[model samples]
Target: MSERPLNVGLIGGGGGAFIVQPHQRAIHFDGTRRVTVAALHPDPEVAQAEAAAWEYPLKGYDSYDDLIKQEAAKPLGERIDYALIVTPNHVHFDPAIKCVQAGIPVFCEKPLTLNIDEAKQLVDAVKEKNVPFAVSHTYLGHWTSRFARFIVKSGLLGDVRWVDSYYLQGWLAARTEDSGNAQAEWRVDPKKSGASLCGGDIGTHALMQLRYVTGLDVTRVQAHLETFVGGRSLDDHFTTYVELSNGGRGLVRASQIAIGHKNDLGIEINGTKGSLVWRQEFPEELTIRLPDQPDRTYFRGSVSANDGFLKDLPEELMAEPNIPPGHPEAFHDAFARLHRCFEQDVRAYNDGKPFECDGSKYANIDDGYMGMAFIQASVKSSQEGNVWVNMDC
Candidate 1:
């Protein structure tokens, strides 16, 4: 007999929130998981009304505390299998740590929490609980990302030397927050969005892409967090010169004040022998340039093993399920892939089996902590006259 579907609960995703929609779709992508309960808003009436009007049937609670307390008290199989925390930066740590303490697995949005201290606490709670925890680094779900990781880690790139990883956007080129834009409003507010705006918002995506692909950590950084837009306390443009764990140097930067660039996130890693380039705008393919050889481009669902520089493709990577080439896997597909991988770990945890919440599949608690640490370090570095700061703090 087939296994029953996993039931998911939402801590926040109402009040016209944006990230929650894609997450809900990703949760239901495989039909093996579904959202059954939610604490949609802080206001009890608003939460109930929103839940009642949700696209599907679901129970709603006034707050995450009530939801966690009630659901966690239930016997296994009767309660939500896991919780998805889709709240704002300030709201993340409380519900997430509570869920962890309640022995509920959590899939949370990125930047982990508002600051490194909260992130550290969440990390400790997760470690103590030993529950499955995943941070939603959506782009890491791309097959091309995994493929890039393989190519670089497999020694095909011949030791990484330099990297340029960036996420650029024009959305905040002006003061959109003053125009009643909820997303823009909170993001520019330091109390809600944390210390660095551009860096915490999308810079971490660029940082994670570089780390995910190169398998290297940024050890130190000299950063410049600039607020190009007047009246914003936090930065609209963030740049950092980083020292990698392997002694190589690179830049991990992001800009929200760049006009005409819409979600233009990309990475280029240059090594001693070859280089690899990938752009999220063109998610379907990755390019590799090697000296004295024709530039080789590999598309999703079309790569072959034993093709000159590419050899012995891992059976697992090759067999990982994806739509056929030309079907075009995009944003929702990437989100679904993350949820799909996360589902396996959740199921394993549910079964009391040895599960892998390793960073290989999805961003785990450690990766989340690292992101927080990176942001903290970058902010400190910028505040100290753009001086280099060690990441150990």
Candidate 2:
């Protein structure tokens, strides 16, 4: 039976928020979900104004607290099915906890929260409330990302030896924050962005990509967090040499000062059998290299299970919803994939049925906590004279 579209409420995304745009498009991608209401800004007046002037019709509240209280009071069908928090780093914890306590599913933006302590609180809250929650690690939604996970975790790659997960950008190469760029302004501030700017922003994405693909945790880290731009309170370039739980070594790195690189996020994994490489710039394909053999390039929607290189493909993955092979799914598609998976869990929760918010479909609240722990470890390692530090989760 076809169901009505899931209603989603917005906690942030006012005053020219960049992340909110992709999320908006993604939520409505399948016609199964829609943003019905929003508390758009920090200021109550501005939030109401933005809602009133919104391109489409939506209910506006003075603040997230007001939005939460009123929405939670409604019956299941009338209230929002889930809430999407696109607020800054510092605003994540409060609203997310409130949503969980209110029996509302939440899909929050990452690094999760401003600090490890808040992340701990959120982890506990989600566990206690047992609500469906997700952290927005966008690239994980890519079809090729799931394909890579199948290849590595299924032992096609043999025992992992080394991996390099990186996200690079050049937009913040200069002091764009000083020039009245709202996004850059909060990002470079430690009070708002937490310990490390580059690490908290995109470095966590690299870390998560590595973890999701390799199915390994970073047990320890030797990091070098650097601030290339002068007068910045936080690091603009973040790098960490990591010890994986499976006895493998890897690097999780990100930089905002690498000129000419625009969202150049990619991952390369080296194993005893062969290697796998994926780049977001070319989102449609992944390259595989094996000893004394031809390099095989696999494109989305164009794979056969019984191929020698790939075997025992899961039916769920093969049956995952997508357009055609060469149709070219990009940023918005990736976001939509995440939200689509999230919607199922929300539906199950509302029906009082078992639902898995496990990392298999999308990053769960635990993944969000781990991201915070990693950043805290990396920052401590860098501050302690670039010494190795064990992750304190």
Candidate 3:
């Protein structure tokens, strides 16, 4: 017989927060896992009200402390299997570390914590607790992303030379925060969003894509963080010139002031033999370019092993379920893939089995730490007149 569904507890995501909706949908995408409880808001009454008004049935708490403490005291089968922390950057470290210490697994949002020190502390806590921790670098869940990682790391593109990774958006171009936009308000505030707004928000996505697909660590960075919108304290534009571990150079850039763009995140890597490109806007396909051949585009559900240019495909990659090539698999589907992979490790943890939280299927705690380190280095590089700063992680 199949096991009972894994119970998920939310640590934030109340009061018109946009990111939570996608996460909620992803959490319940498969019947095997669910949002059984939540501490929805910072305000006690508001949190309770929101939970009561939640679209589905769930236990609610006023704060993450209550959620973690109360839920953790229950028996294994009855308590929350894992906690999903969708709080702002500043609130991340506390609840996450508490969950870790309480023997609860966590699936947290990006950029880890507000600073490198907090990130390091959280990392150390996870190590000591030995629990499953996943950082939601959502794009990595795309099948095309997995295929791209395989292509580059498999040496099909030869030794890497250069890369360009970027994410652009237009919503913050004109001070949407001033307009009382809940998402925009917290994001533009330096106190709440942490240092380097664009970098911490979406630039990390670009940084993670480069690191994930290429499997390379950024050793050093020369960065420039700028704010185009008149009175904002944090940057709306971020760019970094990075030195890769493999001796290649790359640009990881992000902008919120680009007017026409909307979530235009993409990457291009040029190696000795060829190049690979992927754009989240067109999430379905991955493109490959060889020296003298026409570009080959591979769509999800349309690949096979041992094709002329393709080598042996990993069984896990091939066997992942998807609709036919023509039918689209976009954002929510990508998120589901992440939660699905996370579920396996979570299940393993619950069963007292050895599980890998090793950056392969999803962004693990180490990956999250690297993101904070990258942000800290980029901010330092920008502040120090754009000089090269070693990523001393």
Candidate 4:
């Protein structure tokens, strides 16, 4: 039997779009999944040029509504199987809801929707339609994340007790939010960006990472979220104390206005027996510190130290990989790996087989809901003078 290819319609991808290219490349790179750009919706000339560059025979549209309407007119099987929403945070909900209601699956960018209510509405729509959907939380795809999971599962880090995670950046240190940098503008606007800027944006990533490796849900949080950059409508720094369901404690901080910092997201988890640390800057190496033995370092793709999950990566990706044992795989590779997992699960869903990664196992509607809840609770707590807020995720 021949496998059917998935027709993908992209909502945003103009000449200078940042994320669309990675999504396109990831979908096309895996031969098992033949992805065709069914339609590109942007400024007509730019979209047409992009389609031509990709060698897609499809035409381009200037409006998303036109693209959706035309695609919906096709028969179910011939219609676009999935729509990738690569627009900004504020632009995510409407296109996604339309696609899901039309019986097309959707892969949306992170911070699923603008706020808790919007996120819930999108989740309800997808559930009502019973379509397979996913959100892009790319850091969960890192090799070091896989290794950290192994250490926790193997009981090498017995009974995790505490976690410390941070995501810091220097780009917005000087109030760039008001300068109309397309990305920064919407993100700092309360109307478009939703509440809790730094926490709502990158804090979701940190929370997802914490849960992914340790399998613990955040039960409550006491937070101090600050808008350090003068005149910015949203937060630039977030410091929160988190209580986990499994009796573990955690501290999470995300800052976009921190001067002199780069893209630094690092996590340290301490357990009864030992501790494990992974830093995004050093994506290939995991630090292991045991009570009885000297601290050790585990490297990705190493014959001696590679864990099962690391060893199972596609040979092509493993061969002459960007990282040596001590070197690192950059952000794009992590994004690609996540896209690969999304593709596998989507195919499995279409084929009536068990999903390669359980939708619930990865971050899903519930995680999105929880992330929003975290944002709301954190903000409420901050306004109330740093009181503890219960999160019902």
TM-scores, one per candidate: 0.99, 0.99, 0.99, 0.87
Give the poorly placed runs of model 3, Cα more than 4 Å off: none
Model 1 C-alpha lDDT per residue in residues 1-393, reported as the tens digit of each score: 888999999998998999999999999998999999999998999999999999999999989999999999998888999999998888999999999999999999988999999998999999988999999999999889999999999989998999999999999999999999999998998999999899999999999999999999999999999998888899999999999999999999999999999999999999998999999889989999999999999999999999898989999999874679998988988899999999999999989998999899899999999899999999999999999999954
| Deviation in Å, model 3, residue 387 alpha carbon | 0.4
**Higher lDDT: candidate 2 or 3?**
2
Pairs of colliding residues, candidate 1: none
User: In model 1, where is the ten-residue run with the lowest total lDDT?
Assistant: 318-327
Give the alpha carbon lDDT tens digit for every residue of 83-130 in model 3.
Answer: 999999889999999999999999999879998899989999999989
TM-score pick, better of 1 and 4: 1
Local error of candidate 4 at residue 106 (angstroms): 1.2
Q: How well does model 3 score by local distance difference test?
A: 0.94
Off by over 4 Å in 4: 1-4, 38-58, 178-180, 303-328, 354-362
Which residue pairs of candidate 3 clash?
A: none
Candidate 2: minimum summed lDDT over ten consecutive residues — where? Answer: 318-327
lDDT of each: 0.93, 0.94, 0.94, 0.75
lDDT of 2 at 92: 92
Please list the residue runs of candidate 2 whose C-alpha ends up more than 4 Å from where it truly belongs after superposition: none
Error of 2 at 15 (Å): 0.5
What is the number of backbone collisions in each predicted candidate, taken in the order shown?
0, 0, 0, 0
